[model samples]
Target: MRVVSLHSPAKVSGISTAGARLSRLPPPHEPWTPLLIGRALTDEIVRDTPLHDAPGLALCAWPADMSPVGQVLLVRERLRELGARVVIPNDLYHGFVAAALDHHRGVRVGAWLHAEHHDGDELFERCAPISDAWRCVSERGLARALRVGAGLDIPPAGEICPACVEVPPACAAPSVDGPLRLVYAGRLEKHVKRVMDLALLADELDARGVSFTLWVAGDGPARLDLARAMDTHIRAGRVSLLGPVAQHDMPALLTSADTLVLVSLSEGMPTTVMEAFACGRIACVTAGCGGAVPLIEHSGVGVVVPTGDMRAMAAHLARFAADR
Candidate 1:
């Protein structure tokens, strides 16, 4: 199957990594064609790639900053031209439905939802008119979708399509020989990822007399706060901010640390968490991270703390220090 993937231009940097991993899937022979937007002339890259062929399928992902109505129109037009089906978020489909007073473009519509808010049932009921199939990444996601679809009177056309881990194998695991090392490997932001929780954990660890090292990867608005917090730690030789490292250098960073950490306030199954797991490195995650916690717990691959709970975080750090 030829699948056309829609994602933001920011993620285009990792296309080679994503494509390489997808190509290795023992499969129904499905390959991906990534369609990136939100960058300068990204259409050129899309047109030049081998994925522009006809008779393919389209998969829209990363619901952030998405305009479902505009995306649906684009998807509909592209599907008609390529003879491909359109798969997108239920939210996107709802937008399409609103603008589609003229009727949907008659292409099969699938909802690929990974997470939901408490009021998702009400939100999804709003899309009964346009969705044909539904896919959720986890059992919780499936339940939420079902409840919402049922409430909306949009009986699903089939069973759920579970989300899979798309993380690539880290070439090596970080060696745990020196100071207790903890690394955060995703974008550093406040609204979504609870990066502040990590900062607090560092403070807690220091106050508790725990000797360790903290390495932060990626960059964002939180850099200044992280910098202020790291000064004392850096002076004490306890923390180091590597800034935004390239995606390809991630495995090396991952393998360099004894453990990985993320205190996200919300997530749709973070790719970084999966990469940490795949590297066989233990992780320290917050409850705000959905779905993947169960996998982490089931695999005995890491520790989970209540969202924003620095006390619990400190305790976990103590454990890691003891074991180390």
Candidate 2:
């Protein structure tokens, strides 16, 4: 079967990384293709390697100003050209396009929930009616879908398709001798990710006299502002901004850090936490980080603090640092 997975640009974010991995790891008998929309990144790791060489993947740059109807038509034509029998839209824009294609006799559409927040609710309401199936990145996301389905009078049928990562044979344990090494890998955005809170967390940690080093990987609109906010830390070598590390390099990055930190205001299921687990590293996340909270709590993988509570996060990290 030919499957087309539609997603946003092939950037250094979780969705883009997951889409790239899916393109390369399809069933032997099924030719799964990732139809990435928008301009491609020129990053050495992202644009030059896996995405370019991955089999059955197609990259296309569409005009950003294209009308919604036009985008849908373009996607429909692309699907026909690719002979895609199954369409999975990983984002809301492509979800709408996939929903429109549900009328096609030979094609099946699946609505994917990547978050458990307001946007997830919106996606299900707008696309679930026409979607032949529902898929979510985490159990929390799947539950959210069922709840939304109940409200929308849609059937309760969806599967949890958690984010994936290739586990290495062995990962080096975090060193017990130096300053606590923490890494945050994701888009530096304020709204959902609340990346600005990192600045606050740094301040709290400094106030507590916690010895630590934070490495932030990934870039977004808030990058400049976050850099400004952490200027003192950056100058003091307490924080470093490693912009947009590639998916392939993530395991090494995670293995190097004692703990992966995510202080997002909200999340569906962060792929970084899964990668951290695969690399034998724990996580310190906010309670708003959907599925990650329960996973951390149940597994004792790391710590979970209330949303926006930098003081609590600082306290937990301080304990880890002191204990280590």
Candidate that scores best on TM-score: 2
Model 2 bad stretches (over 4 Å) = 26-31, 39-53, 151-155
TM-scores of all candidate predictions against the true structure = 0.74, 0.92
- Best lDDT goes to which candidate? 2
Model 2, position 159: C-alpha lDDT score: 63
lDDT score of residue 295 within candidate 1:
71
| RMSD after Cα superposition, model 2 | 2.5
